[model samples]
Target: MSGTRRLFAELAILGGLILVLAALGPFGSYATPLGPRLLHWALYLVTGYAFFRPVIAAGSALARQMGMSRLVAIAVACVLGAFPTNVIFVFAAAGPAWRSVTASDLAGAYLQTLIVGATVTIVQLLAERGAVPASPAPPTPALPDPQPAAAADATEQEVAPALLDQLPPHLRGPILCLENEDHYVRVHTLHGSALVLIRMRDAVAQLEGQGERVHRSWWVARRAVAGAVRQDRNWKLRLIDGREVPVARASVADLRVLGWLGDAPPAA
Candidate 1:
């Protein structure tokens, strides 16, 4: 399914689940009126999903680059995210009187929300992992060659790879990078970015060594690196379009091999 359609479907499922949960009124929420109870759970579930989904996705990607296991990454992400999410939830739940909120209240709420968040994140991850089949043979499409760009006015333009073809025609300019966002792979070109429901590994393979995997969730084309930036101990490639793509610490040696960086001391 297309990325947008798949997202809608997932939201629909979550919506239905919320309705069921609200009706059942788990915990002491049963005492609240139906209308308020429904609203409360909807706010809780929807907000949790929207907030933590990206954190878990990005955290997992970073953790993989750090050589941590996926489950360990998810656990760390949930633990770290729980505090901020709980704070927001409490403030929203307690509105105008937010100042009355106490540390104990936050502690109690954090534990409860952490369980729910961890459960939801894990289930979603497992579902995604199971949905992905073993990688099939890479598709063969005529990827644009670097040589053709010198003669920009050539009548016979090289076709973009199968991955790039998935983008809308207008956004099919030279690909600057690819980013793994949740279950979708975002294809970024100078024109713009659009997400496709493809695995990051599969997407990188389709590039056929034309691009470099600078991070677990990011792949960058050679021509796209306009410069490099060193931020403290971390590094990133400044893309031609002015976006910074992170360089995984684990992949630093590989980047050195590519000569993207030179002997520069990290910030003191």
Candidate 2:
């Protein structure tokens, strides 16, 4: 589904569930029928509006960094959110109803929520897989032929040394790029990671020849990508050291072209 349509659907579901809970509230005696209905509707609007900002912000950030469709993330979040929300309603009504909320009730509610979430997740995964296009194999770069012994000796070589030496000894190893809350780039390398007082773009430029930007906040060594997994409608690129990077839709094509998504043996 499109992002906007999915968002509207989530809002509708949230509203509907809130209404259902309010109507079924603690023997229906904790509030007048009208009062519960009005309260649910009002809370839906107010809380929904309040949560929308952070939800959108987080979704966008994840989408950019992880490469999953924002719509899928939002839908999953909404489905998972229903249970806690219903529990909140139960707790809120407990005091007024003079009845304690029981473990059984909470357990039952959580089980139901899990079932619903799993169902939604499975359906979305199937839909996304069906929508994936069968793509052509990517082209491999050509290698040059070796020179003869005589020519090799005559050739004046001004070979560039490894860039790894430029960095401190401790900072040399597999690197993970992270975007900080303050919008700065944090580089985690094998020797040790550090938060550079620089923008992500600048960091990327500096690390240009060393690694590729696999995600918005991730610049990984080309050799680091160990495998790929289809999670719901999204793809995650797994690194050799167990780091997982989200593959964005915009980058999917490029990744494929770079042979990142090709049929290859899975990492051990």
- Predicted structure 2: clash tally: 4
- List the lowest-lDDT window of 10 residues for candidate 2: 152-161
Provide the TM-score for each candidate, comma-separated: 0.56, 0.38
Candidates in order have lDDT scores of: 0.69, 0.51
CA RMSD for every model?
8.5, 16.5
The TM-score obtained by model 1 is: 0.56
Which candidate comes out best when scored by TM-score?
1
Q: Return the lDDT, model 2, position 84.
A: 61
- Scored by Cα lDDT, where does model 1 land? 0.69
* Candidate 2 residue-wise lDDT, 44-71, digit = tens: 3344344332444555465565545656
Model 1 error, position 186 (Å)? 1.7
